[model samples]
Target: MLAKLILRNLLHHWGSTLLSMILLSTGVGIISLLLAVNKQVEDKFNRDLKNIDLVVGAKGSPLQLVLSAVYHLDAPTGNISKEEAEKLLTNPMIEQVTPLAYGDNYDGFRIVGTDSTYLLKYNSSFSRGSMFSNPMEVVAGSNVAKKKELKIGSSFTGTHGLSKDSDDDHEHFKYVVKGILNPTGSVLDNLILTPVESVERVHSERHEHAEHEQHEEGHDEDKTTGKQITALLLTFRSPQAMFSLPRFINESTNMQSASPTLEINRLLGLLGIGMDSVKAVAATLLLVAGLSIFIALYSRLSEKKYELALIRSLGCSRMKLFTLVVSEAILLCLAGFAGGMLLGITGMYWLNEKAADEYSFTLITNNLWNKDQFLLLTGTILIGITAALIPSVKAYRLNISKTLANA
Candidate 1:
């Protein structure tokens, strides 16, 4: 009977009830979506940074170097000579060094030039065929093969720049798809792998072609330099190397070194500022929602006083009247929470689709249950209960004789 009464009251004041729910739901949905995206980005970086110590690249921003070399999400600073990078590999403190050479792309997916060790870093294995053994031979990442419809022995020419829209095509240098890699859900899953020499060869040819064109046009061409690698991903043999190696390289050499841990934290700190602003907006919305609930219940008390008094006169307890109002508030809160969760879920699906297509960064879609989410839900319920308390108290203290006389 109490549930029926509460339902009727809410239905009769459907405009106010729906307005309150819309405000609450919009707040909750924004917060939930932020949480999911932040968590997924952190997870993706942590997964991809496994077993890496420092990135050595041409002198520029450390963050850019890390983002380009480690995450493969941005353009490289510039290229450093292979000879200069090899010297770092010869450092006694260095355990491993994998050279990266990248300057071209196929359909917006980057082509990375590295060795077999790059495959081992991501725990990737051949899904078909064998690793590239010759210049211009390439191995396709799982996502690249699936999306680009590449197979063993298939050939594709690369565009000159990192973006798919590059007008400069390397038509003469066709890369054969020598292998396809198993999906490891890391940065490697979006790249096309080839020998570093292949990248140097293609760019060298490009340079020669440009020079030839300049000569034909009676323009002066600058002197060309040696073959260059984009960056070197290094692992150290000892903790002592962290203390000295990156500092020494930055101070003495033309190459700059960036720590994965420091740069990633710096990136997150910048992201936090934007996220905090969003959270503040959501909190403000929630506060407005609380105020709306309080108004809805308080304004209805005068109109419902007679009905409430008659129910009390007919043997309905004062506590029952209080419970009815409170129940209505609780129901609205729960309904809003459910709607918000659905909205958040839809946002997550959209993010997953974009991430997968662009970066091959697959977010864990199932792990939505967490302590923070629970706390948010609990806090919202408390807000509803608190808003309903004052109105419920007024209903409980009603004078049956006075209310009926006024009516």
Candidate 2:
């Protein structure tokens, strides 16, 4: 009887009831998107950083080392000699190692030169052809393969530096697209990998030209300069080495080492300011939703005072009347929440598609179902009950003679 009464009461003002529902659903959808974005950012970072434990680079910002080494999103602070990196790799604390040579690009995509271990460590297998067997032989990532429209045996000259459309093109040397990696849903998905020796040779020729251009007869011929690596990724003996080795590198050598775990946290903290503000706006919207429930229910209750008086005359208890109004509020909120969720999910998929095209940041399509959303639903329903409380109390008071007389 109560459920039937509740449904009928909501149906009495179907337009207003639906308005409440719309508010709740819109609020919930916004909340869901915020939570999913945070998860996406962190998950993608971890996905690409599966193999690297320690990033050894020239002394600078730890975050810089991480961004440069792992994502190729930042310029390197400087390079380290192969000899210094090799010596560190030989340390008993280090399990395995690979050096990254950056600072070259092809059509804005970063060119990475690392040993074969980079592919082996990530377990990245080629979809076509094979890994670089010798210098100047390059393997493209899935994004590179698809974007550049290249296949095995295709040759392309790489441009200099991280920037798109570099001022200097290493026109003398062109790399053969020897292979292409299958998609790993990582930063590696966009990289072009060649031999470290190729990178060294390009810089070597540049330095020699610069000296020759100066036309200084004997400017202390730079011999110590040979193959250089932008950064080195080290695998530690155990998790303990993550902490111990960074300290060891900082204290024992002129070189700097950074742990990805620490640097990633620091970066996240810096990034959260914008995310936090957006979340705050989402929270404010939910608050407006709750207030909407309160206002809509209260306004409808005013028109029902005479009806409540008539119900009391029919022997329906005041408590039952109150429960009915509260129940109506809940129905509206729940309907709105469900509608919002469906809309939110559809929008998320579209957003992901756009982001993939515009930024190449792959977003996984997964519906959000978490504790935060559960709590949100519960809290919205509770607000509905609170909104109906005063009306319920008024029904309990009845004032049957006065209400009927006034009507």
Query: What residue pairs clash in candidate 1, if any at all?
Result: none
Query: Residue by residue across 1-407, what tens digits does model 2's lDDT show?
Result: 87888888778778777666776777777767766767888888777788789888988988898888987778897888777778886688888888899889888788888888888776788899988978888999999899899899999887888877567888888889999999888887888999898788778887777778666765655555656789998888888887688888888776788888778987888889878988778667667777777777777667777888898888887778777777777777787778767767766788877765344476665647778668867876776677667766766787877999999
Q: Kindly report which residue pairs in candidate 2 clash with one another.
A: 21-336
Question: What tens-digit string does per-residue lDDT give for candidate 1 at 183-240?
Answer: 8878888999999988989998899889989999999968556879999999999978
- Candidate 1: TM-score? 0.93
TM-score of each: 0.93, 0.80
lDDT of 2: 0.79
Off-target runs (Cα >4 Å) in candidate 2 are: 1-26, 165-168, 206-225, 270-277, 307-324, 338-360, 392-405
lDDT of 2 at 23: 68
Q: What C-alpha root-mean-square deviation, in Å, does candidate 2 show against the real structure?
A: 4.2
* CA lDDT, every model vs. true structure: 0.89, 0.79
